[model samples]
Target: MSRSSTGDRGQTEPLAALVAVSVMALGLALYGGYLSDVLPGNSDRHVEGATQDRVWNEIQTNGVFDESTDIETVLVAGSTGSNEATDLPEGYNVYVAVTRVGDDGRTEVVDSHYFASDSSPAGDTPSDGVPDAANNATRPVPVRESPGDVEGGRLVVSVWT
Candidate 1:
């Protein structure tokens, strides 16, 4: 006398589960695109190829810290699409630190670190705060080589996305 069958109920449960899983997968994909800078207005703050090549060239050609006024510390900054973006993320992969260049033109990483956001002490921003340390208690990066025949005395910094 029953119009509904137990087999139909079992099939319905599996179908419902499958639909829920599919929806969850789609939501995760959308979120990943949004976070990976693939979505519209997403800021792709990656290291420029020219910048990296230039720094490497300087190190290879001029030789690391060959002069007395060689670069001591470098502060790498990262942000979302040049300041024209909205709701910038609170943290990025940019780093800040001091490095010592040897006569062989090799850069030796010394103190590498990043700064957290001003809002959350436990959070990080898309910018590097090494420059602020120049005026603060942070000590001037040790000058291993003096400026003698060096063309540019700026530090060589490399950033990764």
Candidate 2:
């Protein structure tokens, strides 16, 4: 009887240890997934959304589309290589276009600007068309033509890795 009791205790200890190890491993795996934002509702898309918000905020705060501001001049100069400096983030390709819907319901680009990064030739605006990046963020900026005349337009900022 004594020998049997001792043997049972030894087996129980090993079983308990095995269970503890498995639980610890599971906990570590969950933590790692959370850290990497692999869980539901926390993903790379969230980061991309945040990037879009940041770009929109920058455009609004800088008055990029306001006709009264010099941001258009700065962007145009940057795009033309006359001024290499730009307010856009590094490695980002920016396109700004102000379009108007005519009486015939046709949209026309009243004004436009483009900028490309030095390292990315593909970021350059296509000769006959717009930038051809699939992964891009766009924000509609309210264009104030005068003190009270506001129009609707979009500012697109595309980023590539």
The best candidate in terms of TM-score: 2
lDDT of 2 by residue, 65-121 (tens): 565444345443445464543445466554544555555778755555555553223
> After superposition, which runs of candidate 1 have C-alpha atoms over 4 Å from their true positions?
1-12, 38-45, 48-50, 60-63, 68-161
Tell me the tens digit of each residue's lDDT in model 1 across 1-161.
Answer: 76865665645577899999999999999998777776433443533233334333332333443332222112121223332111212342222334555568886553333333321212122354344322111222223343443322334333333
Assess each prediction's global lDDT (C-alpha) against the native.
0.38, 0.54
lDDT winner among the candidates? 2
Q: Which 10-residue span in candidate 2 carries the lowest summed lDDT?
A: 117-126
lDDT of 2 at 139: 61
Shift of residue 94 alpha carbon in model 2, Å: 3.1
